[model samples]
Target: MSLRCLIVDDSARFLEAARTLLERDGVPVVGVASSGAEALSRAAELVPDVVLVDLDLDGESGLDVAAELARCVSSVIILISTHSLEDFQELVAASPARGFVHKSALSARAIRGVLGENGTGSAP
Candidate 1:
């Protein structure tokens, strides 16, 4: 089955662009939230298969949100950021996120790589 996704980010432009890009690449974006509160609420409602969360959600911490999601939901959480992975490697490793994805490298293939897919299936 295609992976259902929920994107949590503070930037409206990034959210839209990501939604468009992922959908174009065959990953169905189930929902989007601009804040941790909204993300939690939407996640509860959507029950997506995966969630791409911004490492920095404006004044909020995406790591905190990811942890909360991990505790409350069954979805795979991935942290996304414009910053370099090296900058947040330790923190990313400590967080509940499955992995980190650079915003510039965000794609179905990249996501599939994180999920350890061998490209034998359709979804990431």
Candidate 2:
């Protein structure tokens, strides 16, 4: 089954670009949110198969959002950022999110590789 994605990023520019890119790459983007509240609401409404949250959500941690999303949905949660993975390796390991995907390398293939077929998360 294909993953129906939701993107959560505080940047409007990044949101548009990411939605466009994911769609072009054949990942159906179900929704986009720019805030923690919005992301929660959209996830409840869309029940997407995957959610990609930016590491910096205008000062709020994306890992926080990922935790909440993981609590309620079976969807795969991926942390995406311009930051290096090593920078957030510990946090990512501790998070309930399935995996991390750099924003520059965001793609359906990358996401799939991280999630695998079951989409079970990686927790520290």
What tens digits encode model 2's per-residue C-alpha lDDT throughout 37-67?
8999999999998899998999788999999
lDDT of each: 0.93, 0.89
Q: TM-score of every model?
A: 0.95, 0.91
lDDT computed for candidate 2: 0.89
Candidate with the greatest lDDT versus the true structure: 1
How displaced is residue 17 in candidate 1, in Å?
0.1
Question: lDDT per residue, candidate 1, 1-124, as tens digits?
Answer: 3579999999999999999999998899999999999999999999999999999999999999999999989999999999999999999999988899999999988888898876566543
Worst 10 residues of 1 by lDDT: 115-124
- In model 1, where do residues sit more than 4 Å from their true spots? 121-124
Say which candidate scores most in TM-score: 1
Clashing pairs in 2: none
